[model samples]
Target: MAERSEEVKLLGMWASPFSRRVEIALTLKGVPYEFSEQDIANKSPLLLQSNPVHKKIPVLLHSGKPISESLVILEYIDDTWQNNPILPQDPYDRATARFWGRFVDEQIYVTAMKVVGKVGEEKDAAVEATRDLLKLLEKELVGKKFLGGERLGFVDIVATLVAFWLMRTEEVVGVKVVPVEMFPEIHRWVKNLLDVDVIKKCIPPEDEHLNYIRARMDRLKLKSV
Candidate 1:
């Protein structure tokens, strides 16, 4: 692999939001890179070796060096490419962007996962927690067209799934995780972002994405029973 040092590759999964994030950022920046679709369940040796810590997809292999974690990869892409400028330029603004980036990935993303795969009191608590955290994001998007302003940036890219994926997840599970009536601002932001031709192209087809979610939820429900 030594000769492949200069080559850029992304190990990803079609259904993975993390993978989707890196793909969108790369496309937006006009960076050329090869993509290797990973079978997440079967796992790949390269995926394991690249991300030994978490053993996850969306690992960026740049110049033979591996970068793990989707949020971190997004920043690395921004810094390395430097053309499109994913983060805000001002010092305070950049820090604020990163701050919100972390908040979405940590607080909101984690809680959103809990909305699925649980039942009764557990599901209720998860729904409440996820909704409460989303309210914070709703407040964050109160004034901005995108999380980072007029353009999609770190926060917006990292939050790709928090809105889109959750929307589909809520539908498949028949839950109210992202009630449009309650979080108008966030939903509006979602529509704005997805409406973009570039980003829209990166997303999986609606029927395919929904079917994937529905099948996964069905499997989870069966296991629970």
Candidate 2:
């Protein structure tokens, strides 16, 4: 029998897509962990102690050793566990998957946040940038069921995180970067991704997420006024 340990801990925030990414990865791997919800605004002592540098949520602690960064944590989870493989076996395919994963971080997530956080012309520009990024993703998904072709892989995980945040931002900002008619491929991808049992259950309640973003946007609006 394999040695069973009970030392895995995940520090996360409810509204954070990064946190969701880590949670999904762990759940997919069937790794048992204790989840500690962190108040990012208040900053928990345990979170600060575990991730002294970034002091960010979504920190994974295995046997008391903490690891920060969602992508790095995903890689860690995939590498440490052998039962459910998240990455591809072929080196070239793995690199492609990693490229798309990084692309989601750099393009979709970065642009979507900027779009939601800005006002007037800046906000319009950000929306345009996000639309362009989504168009690119649409092209990428032309003939694929998932980013890894058939199965949900690393790139799919990253892309799903982007979609989750983007959807919330759209509700809060009262703008649609991903117009369903314009980007049929991405719309299809979003529907497919959300249909997955784990993802459907793992996503934060939609109304709750929307309310959270709306509150933040209202605060920003008040600050500007």
Candidate 3:
């Protein structure tokens, strides 16, 4: 793979699933970039300048230009790299991919958050909602190996929250959102996503990631107390 001449920099936090999305995409396209580990709490000047509107990490700086937001950054990466193509060439297929990517953001992740640290009737209701949301995905995935069909695409990258983060959150909170028998399609999709080489490189070691979540949740609990 020929490296891009322009310097590429990624402003990201390791714990952020969004940042992980950018990392996976760059690795898949074999794009070389400098990773600037940002202290979001402190809000680095460069990070602020790059993403003034969102003031968020996972900003991709290609040459002197800045692209913010994980989803928007993802589109920019695909357009710029033009290799290993994250979205299918077919117009309808590309549109389908975009729709699902938004669904993951708007529906899946938002619904799953309701289950985190929630209890009693609220937790139960949230769990049910999450189940319903996942069922839609399970149906879509019935005849396909991946959400992206043959390759890891935009939908697969965006669904990292479902594939990895949600499972970790469930372990920490002891609320099981996905069970193998209940969500076989999601389970299979996750297994296939984990098997992807670029994904493996981007995901933090299981022990490290789990420990981080455990510590973060403990902090949250203390705050509530």
Candidate 4:
């Protein structure tokens, strides 16, 4: 096995769920990389230069070549490090994994963003839409341990990240979209995800995240008022 180059670096935000996805992938693959924390509000020069298009964190720099976008970076990581592969080997399984991953990116991500940023009827609609999506996810996870089955695969990582953010957004909006009783499967999945050693270490402290969301909600309320 070829040793991964030491020059790989990850530019990421501390509290970003997107960045957490990349971090988990790297850890699961046992790929060593330097982590540079970025303040998205301040917009560090390196982050801006590395990701000129999106100016986002979770940028992967492999041997000086930067790759932006969390999903794109996950593909790059899987391709670069074949060991502890995140995607399935079979063609059909890989495709299925990709489909669920895209679903999280489109439906879950969009609804969670709306719930956190908007208010009034718009926010209510977004919350209800998110609840419906979570119900769908609960049904999908009925008998499966993870989105990609027993092992935590690519889709599981993407979905977990979205779920993490949605849970936080619920705190911010003073609403509960993914109530444990209503979505037992999702609740089980959340426990399974956090039980992983790497994920357990990577997730932000609960109180810290709650405080951050509360402050954000306060700011949003003030702006609206």
Query: Highest TM-score, which number?
Result: 3
Alpha carbon deviation, residue 119, candidate 3 (Å): 1.3
For candidate 3, lDDT tens digit of each residue in 89-121? 899999999999999889988998877666799
TM-score of 3: 0.94
Q: Considering TM-score, which of the candidate structures 1 and 4 is the better prediction for this target?
A: 1
| Poorest 10 consecutive residues by lDDT, candidate 4 | 1-10
The TM-score ranking, best first, is 3, 2, 1, 4
Q: Per-residue CA lDDT of candidate 2, range 115-169, in tens?
A: 7557799999998988888788889999888776787788888777667878667
Residue pairs in candidate 3 whose N, alpha carbon or C atoms collide under 3 angstroms: none
Give the alpha carbon lDDT tens digit for every residue of 30-133 in model 1: 77789999997799999999999999888999988999998889888888778889999899998998888888888887887887788799989999998998
Q: Report the C-alpha displacement of residue 39, candidate 2, in angstroms.
A: 0.5
User: Deviation in angstroms for 78 in model 3?
Assistant: 0.5
| Model 1 pairs whose backbones collide | none
Q: Model 1, which residues run further than 4 Å from truth?
A: 1-6
Better of 3 and 4 by lDDT: 3
Instruction: Give lDDT for model 2.
Output: 0.82
Which candidate should be chosen as best, given lDDT against the real structure?
3
**What is the C-alpha lDDT profile of model 4 across 47-164, one tens digit per residue?**
9999999898889998788999898888888998988789999999888878888888888787776776576899789888888877777888989988878988898888866567
| Span of ten consecutive residues with least summed lDDT in model 3 | 1-10
RMSD of each: 2.6, 1.7, 1.6, 1.8
* Candidate 3 regions with alpha-carbon error over 4 angstroms: 1-6, 223-225
Q: TM per model?
A: 0.93, 0.93, 0.94, 0.92
